[model samples]
Target: MWRTQKTLLAALMAASFTILTALDFCQSTECQSYDNVPLNAEMSTQTVTSRWKNVSVSNTVQDMDYFRVSCKKLLEVFPVDVVDGNFVRTVKNCIFSKSIPTPLKAPLRLVAVSKDVIEGVLDLDLSVTQSDHFLHFASGGKLPPGSVPLAHRYGGHQFGYWAGQLGDGRAHLLGQYTNRKGETWELQLKGSGKTPYSRSGDGRAVLRSSVREFLCSEAMHFLGIPTSRAASLIISEEQVWRDQFYNGSVKKERGAVVLRLAKSWFRIGSLEILTQSEEINLLRKLLNFIIKEHFSFISSDDPDRYLVFFSTVVNKTAELIALWMSVGFAHGVCNTDNFSLLSITIDYGPFGFMESYNPKFIPNTSDDEGRYSIGAQASVGLFNLEKLLQALGPVLTKKQQHQAKMELEAYNIIYQMRVHQLFRAKLGLLGEEDDDAYCIAFLLKMMEETQSDFTMTFRQLSEVSPKQLHNRDFSQMWALADVSSHDLFPKWIHVYQHRLRRQMNDSDLERQQRMKNVNPRYVLRNWMAESAIRKAENNDFSEVELLHRILSFPFVTQETAEEAGYAARPPQWAQELKVSCSS
Candidate 1:
């Protein structure tokens, strides 16, 4: 018995050592190194599913028949320009995963891949992959030279007024694939080289802009805003032509890379551009494909198909801008081309959240005139939606077009309601109401006057009781805070507190959770931008890696991390940093 006991203890000690060693290995290099990892390992891949590819991979006009075909495979796909360095390799498969669960033929099917335009389709075989894309930059190998897949066929509005021709100027849609869970998705290569859309331009994405996009996309996802996901970021060692240098050089050249992900890279501009031309047949085909690919739930027989589509897009854009307004997010370029045809958020150019709630925070260095200002996004969104109607006029009947125009006109009201609701939520108020707009305008006025920090002020608004509100000496806010008839805010707060009381059971805690989830503690703060730019310029992705980690759980506080500098606003230098849409 004594001998057996001693032997058991020895074995237990040995097992403990083995486990510790393995954990360290996963934590150290294996988790971070992308190239060295075994691609075939079950632990490395993720299950992908979706109906986006249920249609067809070939650009054939199969109508809805393309929806029935299924594919599953992973082939080692390389880049279009090998010499210039766009080598983002992955297995491409066609599976589209959106809001709905797609009907799939096989559970997990991995196959061979070969394509010229798309590098390759990858089979993600792991049960779970990293949600945040930073894992790749953190531990992965050298980033491939990226090229914007020349998907320039689409068109949309600009600043809610101008209808500009825009396409994937610095973005590439790699291919679609199924992950371990049988989900399908599109993996696009952004910042990859230029396509026909280049139009006398260099197709490249700078590391600074790429990092902002990579971090912000995940941050928005956490905030419950519908947004595109970032899969992997591969920056090249080579520089390209850029008017504004990443390191403050006024030169027209710099090194850049490609960002890969999945989504409808086809912007609203794509549809608008094609419609502007005489491609009537192609326009009809695209409309059919869109319904099958994205809005399948709606049928052709529906009397209000166009209206329904318009309304759906309007509400989505409305909610999207409202969320941005509440968060102080300025999309820098709210141009129709920048707006997703499908109403999803993409293109993080000169994007910034408000440090000061002035409503005119313009982050895009190129947006000199403040056309896409923070306060103006809602109206701008309405402008873009109106263009969608004008573009559809060529296809829809005069009567149908009239109806569509009416629907488009309603965007302003719908957006107003959403914007008001967001303000109430930020102020810890209850549901929608008629007087909501007044309360909102009051808050905005106060914020503007007090020079409140857009994010921090709203996150702290619930702390303001009438007594607290008074003590703060916000006499200016009181002028606007009062309701038209009922001493507005004091009465509203009375009701708000009562509502807050009912939620006291557990909703109080739940409220905090919900608000926090909606409000990210750390954004890719402008200062962090400089840090990411410097590291990326040096081909060091440590800063990028750290930024991804913080952005991954953007709602959670990460004080102890080395990128702790994220907590502060940009120093004087970040102000001098300017970015154009061309970059």
Candidate 2:
């Protein structure tokens, strides 16, 4: 592996440095850098003709001026023969003619002819067009017809237990590249149709789920979390089959293809499942590749390379979980496939940020068991990383693996510590020790008792006076709190207040910025998304615009009451708007 690294570095750095000479990149639209070399250029050329025009552009991420999409690369990825007939574009569209602000919006011009697979992105905007779908069908796009690039694999626990066989099903990674900022990034397409792992399924993504993944990923990035960002989202209205719980009766399948952009779609489960194969060595090879691609900062010769990898990943997972707690996010389906090595929120299926503070709340309507509820996510993340460690254990010496296990085991401690620190910071407190943990748990208990607002609880606490802490309403909720028998919670708040008084920062604005960043004034409230969904379904994009605007500046205070709707919890009716499978 070290020799492989040394041999790969020259070629990799060379490609990566050339403003992104992506290694083995194949798709022309996404894999423009040298690393990306398309296999089906002959078929791609046929999808394009002089008639393709720009359709709808993105709305949320209004930053469209920064990109230079590669059209020639797009030609190489899909088919060239069907270009004239179906109009080559770069996505398998599920959304009709809707506009949502995309994070990296460039003109998404396309050739709009309905076909089996039309996916193309010319040197322009990252918007969706009909032609991309045609290319998917034209190039024998059910699965690319060659030895496909290996799944960037890793191991992770599923539902607190470890089984194997987790690889990309509806996902096919395009490649990785360095952007203009010298930032190394991954570019992979979700719903790029099926792959070898489709496992008797239609391997398509729906637009509804696609939009959620796309927007939420970018939002996490903007919020200073280690999150996968959506570069583009394309929707083709062609009917695809997926399961729908019918009329409170017949539960059957329906379908759609929603193309998504991600930095890296590689998952921990991808590694573990492969371990059960004769291809364990292949798993090792993939691990080496991951080390090279994402963990290049670590020195391979360092006796603690494996330990350091585990530590870095563990810390990242902790921080990510803490951030989710701050904003009240629940990754509805946090199975191995969605547990990216990068630890970013990858799949956005049935995902939601909390409005009211219900620690046990599960966002995925399909998750009857609450496996991915918000309260359990931290534990789940730790469990997943442990599974990863189990897979990587053999790669290092037994001694190294033991050391790695200790480092990984500390994830919960670091996570709880950070989470407590955030809660303190939200209250303008500058310090606390393990006492912080007690207070955090108590606060959660209070939130649950009052059916209190998660964001509002923190927000209002920013200005909480000593007198305010003893409010009759607060007292009633505190009484209902079913937290542990320890009186440590109420005791800690008193200690925290005095601590804050002594260490009050020099600048209120500085304190304000710190608190605001941690505690968002707006989240992607379930009610808000549903409101937008209802209106958007009827051809209205206004609610969508409003929700997008607030989420973009999640930490900001709205200037108007109308804009303040994002802060409210979902009403009972809104809560009942069930989302089964995405799309």
Candidate 3:
């Protein structure tokens, strides 16, 4: 009996330590609340409009004085490659290459800017973004005063095959900025021209893809998902040619650049290159730097720190993928290089939000085999984690390697648990029931059979009353109307109603409010992005600006979004829209 009691106490201590470690990580990063918005739903329309003006433009615009100061923490702390020129060749023994951005041609246009990101994250006055100095700096025409631009070197497995030395071809890490909040953000320029990683291809991003990345980056943030943020999108008259579908029909499109920010750009591939090249010493140095900077909760002196870091990454990666599933988002390219080591969503390309509830939905036209579909993301996540474990093999002992594998084996359980928790919150289920998982599965199956819209079906359920659901009155809820057409929907509704009755303390209004907070009314649908992109290509950024503002508060319903048909059924032309890996 004493032995069993002692074992139980040891388990309790381990669990407590895990909780404290998570708390420490959160404190270190200063976690951003997903629910906070600039506008309040309870306010009158006039008041909301008045408050939006104040919130968006609260700070005065200033000159470019703030651009004089920049930090080089990565350069100061690590060794760079000996090769200094922007030549295409294999690089070794470096975390980054010193590459200068080839400036975009003149006649640059500032298309879109995230005012909230400027004011909140950068702690800069919004007016500072108005000058041509901001445009030039963002587009690589002129570097910030103290910026030391560099390109990250990494490798990844594309689809299922190992693609070696797939580093930053067109991106240049400008410098790091530490804001008033003491949060450090690494700023990078996408489409800032070529580096050593550019292999026979132009190192520029076209306007078509740049607009999508900009809008979706901000949209994902407002949805409460952990993601890289976009500060500005600038377009230029420089021509870029692409065979968008590899069909030999090349076309000329204008170049564009986006200034994006993230805590760290390191991914599983960052270590993969070092391991594959047998750079064990450099790998160890990079690993220690990551732990010291990001994973401070794990002591640098601990011999088992690598194992602990692997475990933390495994748990957070699972949670991040679960959040993606909850929102019906498919990363499209789930390659190891694109998966962030910090567990935030990064490298937005060919991504799509599921319109119809098909688990087989493939967003990237380049994915002919449907390897990175919506339903396959969780499994692909496991595959990437396995690759990550392999990358850490050189540094880990035999016993630690086994422990890391054991931690990886728990990924599916962790992912499913987070998914269940998030879906429960979406359905406003206060307490547990034996049938909760079954209920969620049942509704998804029905949605699949009926081809119901994924985002709106859950959103309509939140807006609907129990009486409406029972009476089958879905006249006003088009998404629910599509769902209710299924004969089994009645059976599912009965099960859901019975489940709701189990909530003792939650009133209908409280339940509705809870559900509404999680179920967003709008997501960046490909069609919506296409519409905005068409106008953006013609130098009409009105739609792009409007979409950004509306998506800033995705949970709250707005009159402009309604009038613009953002919540309506997608147009027929949208079915022909295709996104590939061209850009």
Best by lDDT: 3
Local distance difference test values of all predictions, in order:
0.51, 0.51, 0.83
Alpha carbon lDDT at 227, candidate 2: 67
What are the RMSD figures for all models against the true structure? 17.8, 12.8, 10.7
After superposition, candidate 3 runs with Cα above 4 Å error? 1-61, 68-71
**Position 271, candidate 1: lDDT:** 63
Model 1 Cα displacement at 356 (Å)? 0.4
Model 2 is weakest, by summed lDDT over 10 consecutive residues, at 93-102
The digit string of per-residue lDDT tens for model 3 on 225-282 reads 9999999998888999999888999999999999999999999999999999999999
Query: Candidate 1 lDDT, tens digit per residue, 301-402?
Result: 776676677667877887788677667778888877878767778877778777755766777777767777676677677777777776666778778877
Q: Please estimate how well model 1 matches the true structure, expressed as its whole-model Cα lDDT.
A: 0.51
TM-score, candidate number 2: 0.69
Model 2: runs farther than 4 Å from truth?
1-157, 160-164, 245-259, 433-435, 463-497, 504-510, 581-583
Alpha-carbon shift of residue 194 in model 3 (angstroms): 0.4
